[model samples]
Target chain A: MTLHNKVRQARTQLGLTQSELGVKVSVTRQTVAFIEKGEFAPSVALALRLAKALNTPINELFWLEETAQ
Target chain B: MKQFFSIKSPLWQILAATLLYVVVLLITYDKQHSTAEGFTPARIGMFVAAALAILYSIIYTMAITRYNKRNPHDKLSITGVKPAEIRDEDEGMRMITARATERVYRYHSFALPLSMVFIALSDASAYGVSTILFILTLGHYLTFWRGVWPAFRETSEE
Candidate 1:
C-alpha cells in the first residue's frame, strides 16, 4: 500500500547527506529521512526531483511493492 | 518595540502561554475556595491574569505573522531560518503530527463520555477536570511536535 524507495542508498552512493538531497529537491531533510524510511510517500514532483538530484531514474529509485506484479 | 515583540520562539511562547493559563486557573480556584468573602483579592487577580493571558495570545499571533513574513516559504519560520530549522519542516515530523492529531481526536471521543459518567457519579468539578485534561493534551502535542520531535531529528544528525 506504500511506495518503497532506495533514497538512502542512492544518497549515500552519491556522497550526499539527507540535507544535501533535500536542498536539491527544495524539501526538508526530515522529509528525505521519512521518504527513505517508507514512513512518508513523496509526491510525483518530489520523486522526479529526487531522482534528478541523485542522478538516477525515477523507476529505479521508487516502486510500489504491492503493485510489482 | 517591534523587534522585541517579534522575537519569535514558538516553543517558548507556547510554554509562557500555558503557564499563564495555569496561573489564571489557580487564581480562580483560590477565589472559589473562599467564596464566602465577597470579591476577594484572588477574584481580582483571576481577572487580571486572564486578561494578561489574552494579551499574550495576541502578541504571539503578531510574532508569528512577523516571522512568517521574514522567512516566507520556510515552514519553521517562527524558530527562524537556521540549519536546525530543517528538522521542524521535515515531512517525518509533519506525518508524526498528523498521526498524533488523529489519535488525540479518538482519545477525546472516548474520554468525553467517560468523563461525563465520572462527573455524574462524583463531586469532581466538571470544569476543573476538563480544563486540566485539555491543557495537558494540548501541551503534550505542542511540545512533541514543535520542540521534542524536531530536536530529536536535529540531534540524531549530529
Candidate 2:
C-alpha cells in the first residue's frame, strides 16, 4: 500500500486526540485532522513538531511507496 | 435563510447572550441570600466559564498572530522539498483548511441544542442550569474547533 504520513496511525498508537496532539504541537486540532487525512500538509516546522509529538522520525511520519530504485 | 446567518450577527448574539445570562444570575442572586453571602458555586462557575472563554480567545489571537508572521504564500511544508513537490501538497493543504472549518461549525451547531435539553433538566434548587450550559457550550465548541484544525488548512479552490 502507498504509505502516507503515519500521523493518524501514530496518533492512535500514542492515544492522543487531535486536540491533545494539536496542543502538543502548538497547532489547532483541525490542522492535525487535515494532516492525518492527507488533505493538508504541515509546514516543515509543524511536520517536525508532529513527528516529535508522535515520537517518530519525519521519514517515518511521512513516507511513500519506496521508489523502485 | 442564508441571508439570515450573517457573520456580523454572531458577535452581537454572543454579546447579547452573555449579558442576558449575567442579568439572570444577578436577579437570582438578589432574590436568594439577598445579603452579602458570597461565593456560590453558580457564581464561581460563571466566572470560570468566562475565564475559559477569555483563555480560548487569547490562544486564538496569539495563534493568528503567529500564523500571520509566517509567509502567507510560503510553500507547503518546512521540509526541504523541491519547489515542484511543494506546489501539490500546498494546494491540498488549502483545500483541507477550507473544508475543515465548515465541519467545525456544523458539528458545534449540533451540540448547541443539547444545552437546551440540559437546561430543562436543571432544577431550581440545584446548580445553575445556565452555568452548566455555558461551560459545556464553551468546552464542546473548543473541542470541535480543535478537532477540525487539520482541515482548516485546506484551501477553498481545491
Candidate 3:
C-alpha cells in the first residue's frame, strides 16, 4: 500500500496525532499530510526516523511496486 | 495534484517545433519581405521569446519539480536515494562538471569565428535574429547547467 494507509496505520499503532507524528519525524504536520497523501516523498533520512518512531523496520513501512510486479 | 503531464515530452516537442519554425521563417523571409530590415525586428523578438521559454522550462524542471521527487537524503522512503560510500557526492559532481565544462567550452568557443562569416553576409535583421537566438540559447544552458549541477547529475557523480 501507499503512504496514506501507512501513515494512518502507523499513527494509530503508536497512538500519535498528526502533530505528534510531525514532532517525532521532525517535519511540519502539513509536511506529514503531504507525505500521507503521497503528494510528497519524504527524504531517506526522514523515512528512517518515521520507521524508528513507529518501532517498525523501513520495509514494512513502504512497499515497492517491484515487489508486486 | 489534479492533473499531470509527462515532463520531457513537452520540452522536446517545443524544441523540435521551434527549430522547424526557424527553418520555415528563414525560407519564407525573402518572399515575405521587400526589405531585409523589415524582417529584422520580429525575427529577433521570436528568437528572444523562444530562448526565454527554454530557460523557463529548465528552471521549472529543477526547482519546482524537486517537491515531486523522493528526497535523496531520506533513508526510509521508498524512492529515497541512499547516500552510499561516496562522502560529499558533489565532489564527484565537480569532476564530471569539469569534464562537461571542458566539452561545452571547446564547442562554443569556436562559435564566434564561425559566426563572423554571417556578420558580413547577413542582412541586419538576419544578423539581429541570429545573434538573439545564440544569446538566448547560451543563456538557457548557463542557467540550466547551474540548476542541474546541484541536483540530479551532482547526486549521481563518479
Candidate 4:
C-alpha cells in the first residue's frame, strides 16, 4: 500500500506555494514538494500538522492506495 | 566573497578537493618511499587530517548532487542546505541512501576481515589502514545520523 495525499491540491486551492506550506508546517520547501509528489510519507505528528496547515482533515489529506498484486 | 564562492558549484568544490588530496597523497607516498625518515606521529596526523578532508568532500559531493537533482535550476552553495532538509524533502532518497549505506557496511564487515588478513600477510601499514577505515566508517554514519536526527525533534518549532 502507498500513501497518497492531496497536499498540492489543497495548497493550490489555498493559494499557498510549496515553500509557504512548508513554512506553515515548519518544514523545508523540498519536504513539502516530496510530500506532494508522494515520495515521502510524513510521521503521524507531521501529517496532523500538515492537515492543519492545509485546512484539511487527516483522512482527507492522506489515504492509502491499494497496490497491484 | 559570498557570490565569489557561489559561482562554483558543489561539483567543483569536490573536484578541487579531490585533486588536492591526490597531490598531497602522492607527495606523502614519495616522501615515505624516498626518505630514510621513520614513521612519526606528525606524519600520521598530516595523513589523517588530509584523509578526513577528502572524505568530507566526498560526502559533500553526494549531498550536492542529490540537492541539485532535486531542486533544479537554482544553485545551492556548498553549505546552504541542511541535512534535515535532505531527509525531510525526500523519503525515497533517505530510503535509498540508507539501503546503500547498509550494503556498504555489510560488504565492509567482510572486506575488513579480509583486509586484516591481507595486511598481516603483506607489507601494508596497519596504522594507515585502520585510520582510513575509521574515517570512512565515521563519515558514513554521520551522513545517516544527520538525516534522521530531525525526525526525533519536537514538531512545535521550525
lDDT string for model 3 (B1-158, tens) is 11112231123334544554565455456446636665476576566666766775575446324534644442222233631211122232334345545655665666555555555576446536555455545544454344333323221111
- Candidate 2 per-residue C-alpha lDDT over A25-46 given as tens digits, one digit per residue, 9 for 90 to 100: 8765555776777756667788
lDDT of 3 by residue, A1-69 (tens): 334338668877778876688778766455565466565566678788888888888888766553343
Question: Mind listing the fnat for each candidate?
Answer: 0.39, 0.11, 0.00, 0.11
Off by over 4 Å in 4: B1-104, B117-158
TM-score of chain A for candidate 4? 0.96
- Using lDDT as the measure, which candidate wins? 1
lDDT by residue for model 1 over B1-158, one digit each (tens)?
33222233235445564666677566657846775666676677776777777787677657667666776775344344442212345455556556655655666677667766766777667356656555655654454444334324443331
Locate the minimum summed-lDDT window of 10 residues in model 3 chain A: A60-69
Model 3 regions more than 4 Å off:
A1-69, B1-63, B66-68, B72-89, B122-158
The two-chain DockQ for each candidate, comma-separated, is 0.34, 0.08, 0.03, 0.25
**Candidate 3: deviation at residue B91, Å?**
1.7
Docking quality tier of candidate 1? acceptable
Put down candidate 4 lDDT per residue, A1-69, tens digits, no spaces. Answer: 989999989989999977788778877665676677776788888899989988899999999999999
DockQ-wise, the better of 1 and 3 is 1
What value does DockQ give for candidate 3?
A: 0.03
Off by over 4 Å in 2: A1-3, A66-69, B1-158
**How close to the true structure is residue A14 of candidate 4, measured as C-alpha lDDT?**
95
TM-score of 2: 0.33
Candidate 1 vs candidate 3: the TM-score winner is 1
Residue pairs with backbone atoms closer than 3 Å in model 4 (clashes): none
